[model samples]
Target: MSISTVAKKLPTTAIAATVIVLGIGAVAPVAQATVLTFDDIAPISYFNEIPNGYGGFNWNNFNYINGSSPKVRRTGEDNGRVSGDYVAFNGFGNPALVSDSVFDFNSAYLSATWNNGLSVTVEGLKNGATLYSKTVIVDTTQPTLVNFDYFGVDELKFTSFGGVEPNYLGGTGTQFALDNFTFNEKATSIPEPTLLPALFAVGTLSIGSVLRRKQLNQS
Candidate 1:
C-alpha cells in the first residue's frame, strides 16, 4: 500500500519474470514416434504396390503382400510378416527407398524373402548425402528386429546383397521384407537461439529492479 512496499514488490516480480523466462528456455523439443506396420494397405490376392504419400513417406520399389494369400508361396513368405497379415518387400529384389522431407528412423522388423542370412544394408541420407549406414543379416525362418536409431534423415535406402539362395518360389536371394517400420516424423528440436535474447532482457530488468531496491534502502 505504501511507496516502500510497492518498490520492494517490484524487485520480487521482476526476479519471478526472469525465472519464468529461464524455465521456458530450459525446455527441450520432444520427438513423437510413428509406426508404419503396412497393415493399413488393403490386401490383394498376390501383392499390393505401396504408393507415394503412404504414411507420409514416398515408397520406391516397395510392395506389400498378404502372408496367407494363395498367390504367396508359403516357403518364401514364411515368418516374413511381423504384425497383421501384410508385409512389405523390395519388389523384384531391387534396392528400395523410403523417403520423407525429414524424419528419424527408429527401427523395423526385417526378414529375407527366400534367403537365410541375407545381408541388408540400410543407409540414412539427408539432402542426397549419406549420414550413416548399417548392415544387418536377416533370415526367412524368423524376423530380425533391427534398431537403427537414426535421426534427422530424409531418406532411407535398403540394399540387399549376397545370401544363400533357395530354389523354392523363385525369389532372388537379395529380396528382403520389412514390417513394423517405426520412425519419428520430425527430428528432435534444440532450444531456439532467439530465446537467448529474451532471457537476457529479463535478466537485465531483474538486475535493474534489485539495484533500484538497494538505492531506496540506502536513502
Candidate 2:
C-alpha cells in the first residue's frame, strides 16, 4: 500500500515517467526535427510580404499566433517543390507550421502539394496524446516526398487530409505546399534534471558505505 498507494491506483491518462537515478535509469533522448524547407526563406526575407521564420519554424494561424489575421508569415505563395521553395497552408483553419523545438517524433520526410484533394495528417503530440500518425495525398503537379510513422513525442503536427490517397508525392493546390519536412529529435543528452538530487545522493551514500564496510568485515 506504500509508494503512495501505488501512485493512487495509477492511470492518470498515460503517465509513464521514470527516474531512479541511483541505479541509473532515465528517459527522453532522441533527436532529428529541424528539416523544414521553405527553401531557406531568402526569396526576399520579408516583414513586408510575410513568410519569415525559417529553420526554427513558426506560423500560428489567424495570422501567426494571436494577432487576428492582419498577416504575419505563413510562408505562402512562391510555389515550387522540395528543393525550390514550398510552404503554404490555408486549407482553412487546420494550419500548422510549428517546430521551434520540442520533438521526439520518429519518422518523417515530406513535400506536400495539395489543394481540392485536401490530404495530410502527420501528427505526434504529447501532453495532448496522439503519439504519431500519417496520412497522405497530393493532387500532383509538383512537391512530393511524404512519409510517416511516429512514436513517443514532444509535439509535431500537420493537418488536412481528405482520406489518404497520394502515398508520397503528387499535387493539386487548395494551398498546402510544404516541403522537405523531416523529424527525429528525442536525443536528450542526459545528466540534468537538476543533477538528479545530487546524483541520487551520491548513489545513496555509496551504497551505505559499502554496506557498513561489509558488516564491519563480518565482525
Predicted structure with the largest lDDT when compared to the true one? 1
Model 1 weakest lDDT span, ten residues long: 2-11
Q: Return the TM-score for candidate 1, rounded to 2 decimals.
A: 0.80
lDDT score for residue 116 of model 2: 35
Which residue ranges in model 2 land beyond 4 Å of their true spot? 1-23, 28-40, 45-114, 120-133, 136-176, 179-182, 186-219
TM-score of each: 0.80, 0.27
For candidate 2, report its TM-score.
0.27
Predicted candidate 2 versus true structure: per-residue lDDT over 1-219, tens digit per residue: 354444344433212333343323455464546565444444433222225454444555412121112232222233224454334444453656454456544333333333434576766667777766777765434445555645446556677645333433342344455545566555557664543454344445556867899999999
**Model 1's lDDT to the true fold?**
0.80
RMSD to the hidden true structure, all candidates: 6.2, 14.0
Model 1 over residues 93-195: C-alpha lDDT tens digits?
A: 8899999888889999998888777899999999999999999998777888899999899999999978886665565557888889999878556654454
Q: What C-alpha lDDT does candidate 2 achieve relative to the native structure? A: 0.47
lDDT of each: 0.80, 0.47
Over 4 Å off, model 1: 1-16, 22-24, 166-172, 187-190, 193-219
